[model samples]
Target chain A: MPMPQVPFDDRGLAYGDGVFETVLLRAGVPVLWDYHYARLLLGCQRLNIPLPSREQLVATWQSPPNAELEILKLILTRGSGGRGYATPDNSQPRLLSRRTPFVVNADRWHEGVNIRICQLRLGHQPLLAGIKHLNRLENVLARQEWNDPAIAEGLLGDADGWLVEATSMNVFWQQAGALFTPPLSQCGVAGTLRAALLDHGVVQEAAIALTAIHQVDRLWVANSVQGVWPVNKLLSETGVVLQSWNPAGHDRLQVVGHELLGYSPTSR
Target chain B: MPMPQVPFDDRGLAYGDGVFETVLLRAGVPVLWDYHYARLLLGCQRLNIPLPSREQLVATWQSPPNAELEILKLILTRGSGGRGYATPDNSQPRLLSRRTPFVVNADRWHEGVNIRICQLRLGHQPLLAGIKHLNRLENVLARQEWNDPAIAEGLLGDADGWLVEATSMNVFWQQAGALFTPPLSQCGVAGTLRAALLDHGVVQEAAIALTAIHQVDRLWVANSVQGVWPVNKLLSETGVVLQSWNPAGHDRLQVVGHELLGYSPTSR
Candidate 1:
């Protein structure tokens, strides 16, 4: 059966003129609601899209029965309009949500995961930076750089050769036991977990140059769905191990801070 | 009444992972079919999308009754899939077409139009630079820089400060009677009309510096739907005329060369 779809003229589909949030729903509750809502609000404000009230979002969260884990994604866009890039004056914002069963990656969460460097570099646009907008072709193309099952993620650097992020996660690392993550003022999506970690003060924001990737003591990747996972290996596009690490105990602190919703060890 | 919409999971909506073509249909026959098809093919190939055969497009073009001029927009998107940046294996491309009544802009065509320098400097990403992909928020934001009816278009400069193109059209300028346009190697859409003009040996491709805007003798904008339009005045975002041109008879050469799809004096 066909599912309901967004109107073709919807700006979200047409121009990618919208924002989205991917929430980790555990037991029918969207984890990190405050962080996700904050990011969504910021995205809406930046794009000048009238945000839906908090009550509206609360109503959406009430749907579907309690479950162990489900990926709840919400997309908010400038609604249906005629052809042209200029937004319509009376345009209404449309909000859409979907939920999908998420199988926790027990292997990656427990044993750590391998990631690769993407040849595709992110472009700098401060206006659209930090928000998780729909204009994500860079991520799509970066992800295309590797297809090996062993390669769990791809790291993307900005055009200025600063490590921006992993394909779908925020990248963090420790050097001399000092933890830091890339600042996203120029480019890259500001993941909710990254924001929480920064707010939690356990992670400091810094510009990690792409040339210094190999100098890090330990690497970690985090997102709302997968939580924080220690990066076990770094691979080149050709599947060559450029750097290796034993992340078993390295990410223990982040996991122990799981009470903050930034860590999820779904090792079932 | 609601029209059919694209599936929620379509990668085009999700990641802007697709390409599109906006054509002008005259009496139900698509104008510049060859150029449009060629560009579409290139876009599909660049993104690794399977192109619908020419026959399929021709069949689609057969729809709708004969009309003077209607906008024919065809959007090809990677089909529905799960939440992830990776292009799903064996993903099929979905082709969608819509025809919009195009009121001939007789005034702008005959009297020329006003254009502005966009405040938003487009980011540089060579990989997705030239194609008319779904990721068009830059253009969208640039279009939002002005709302005056007198401003027909806004010109975008790249991150390196080169005049890339107009918000929705290819830009051309004549200096000392030598026609030239900015190269799209770094960024900006390669319009079909721009390609045709380049092929016809009328306009030469050149790197146009944003600082050189005042050095141009005359300016023009071109696209498949609107054809060629003389730019009479260049304005700042505040509607201040930074530069002005009396384009009355200067654009006579382009209009006379309507043999190419570059001119459409829709004065009716």
Candidate 2:
């Protein structure tokens, strides 16, 4: 059967004039409610969309029970509108939530994953940075860079050659016992996991250089769904193989990743 | 009454993963069907969305009775999926067509428009550049740079401080009897008007510099809907006015804008 679909208008389809978030749900409970709410509000403020209240969001998520483990997504758009880029005369934000069974290869999260540098570079637009706004053609293009299921993720670089983040996750590398991730003041989405790690002092933020990335003792990737898994190998642009790593940051990453929604790290 | 709203899972709302076109319909025929169809196909190819044949697009438009001027919008999203950025597996694209009363203030296009430099810098993702893909948070932020009604449009700049285009349209400036526009290979949507102007030998593409704009003899903005309008005032970041513009491009813009649009420029 066809899943029920939404009929969005030009604003949502013409311009990525909205914001969204995917929450990890287990036993019908959405994890990181507060953090996600905060991010959603910030995104609304940034995009000038009148935020549908947090209570409204919560009510929608908890309205009904569904599959035990599912991915809950909240999309907030500027509602339907006419042509042109101007905000509507009267703006009412559209809030929607749906639950679907969340599935992923558990083995990949446990065994270190492999990633390649994508050819597509993210443009630097600070005004639209950090928040998980819907203008993600960059991510879409980056994700489509390869079709090999073996390649777990693709790392993106900004126009100036600065390493930004992975296609769908924030990146962290440990060097000399210090956790460092790229600062997203310019580009890249600040993932929920990266935010938690930053708060817990498990990961640090900095501008990561492409050349310096290989020197890190260990490399790991994190997102709301995929907690954190060390990068076993990185395929450079020239097809040179970088040695695998099991960063010490995994202990903190796994602890939080598991605690968020019971994604315990075990040998797959 | 609240307009129809799409659920968050709408592919248009989710990944900016869709295609769309807005055309002026008058006397029961679309003004620029060929241009809109060509651009829509190009957009579909760029984003990997399957394009409906021109016959399909026109069949829907022709079904409606001929009427006064209307703004016709055709939005196509990958439709709804559970979650994640991947284009939904085997998803049928949602096609939405609506006729809205054409409501642009004629004076803005007739007299001239005030253009202000926006603080929101557009990101340069090449793969998505030139195509009118959804993922328009940058434009939203740019439009939000000002709420002043007098400021007609915001001139958007890229991260490296190069002038990309306006918030919603392509820009053209005449200097020394030659017209120039920002190249869209790195950023900005390649407006249908821009293509027409280039093909008809009306304007040439170039990397517009912040310092060089002041030297131009005249300036104007063009989009499929707006056709072309002069830029009377150019407000810089420091609130300095560039100068006045001669509205000589209107005739040429309208000729190209109306060609094969099935409407005479003088009729409107």
| Strongest candidate by lDDT | 1
Report per-prediction Cα RMSD to one decimal. Answer: 2.2, 3.3
lDDT at B166, model 2: 92
Model 1 TM = 0.95
**Cα deviation of A142, candidate 2, in Å:** 1.0
Flag regions of model 2 displaced more than 4 Å. A1-7, A63-68, A103-105, A237-240, A246-252, A265-268, B1-8, B103-110, B246-268
Q: What is the C-alpha lDDT of each candidate?
A: 0.83, 0.74
Residue B24, candidate 1: alpha-carbon lDDT: 81
**Alpha-carbon error at B108 in model 2, in Å?**
4.3
Q: Which stretches of candidate 1 lie over 4 Å from their true place?
A: A250-253, A262-268, B64-66, B250-253, B262-268
Candidate with maximal DockQ: 1
lDDT of 1 by residue, B70-97 (tens): 8888888887768889889978888877
Candidate 1, residues A1-268: lDDT per residue as tens digits?
2454887788888888898899888878888889999999899888889999988887766876456788888888888877989989999998888877777775666788888888899999999999999999889888877778878888999999999999999999998878999999989999888888888888899888877888999998878777677888888767678789887664643664366663444443
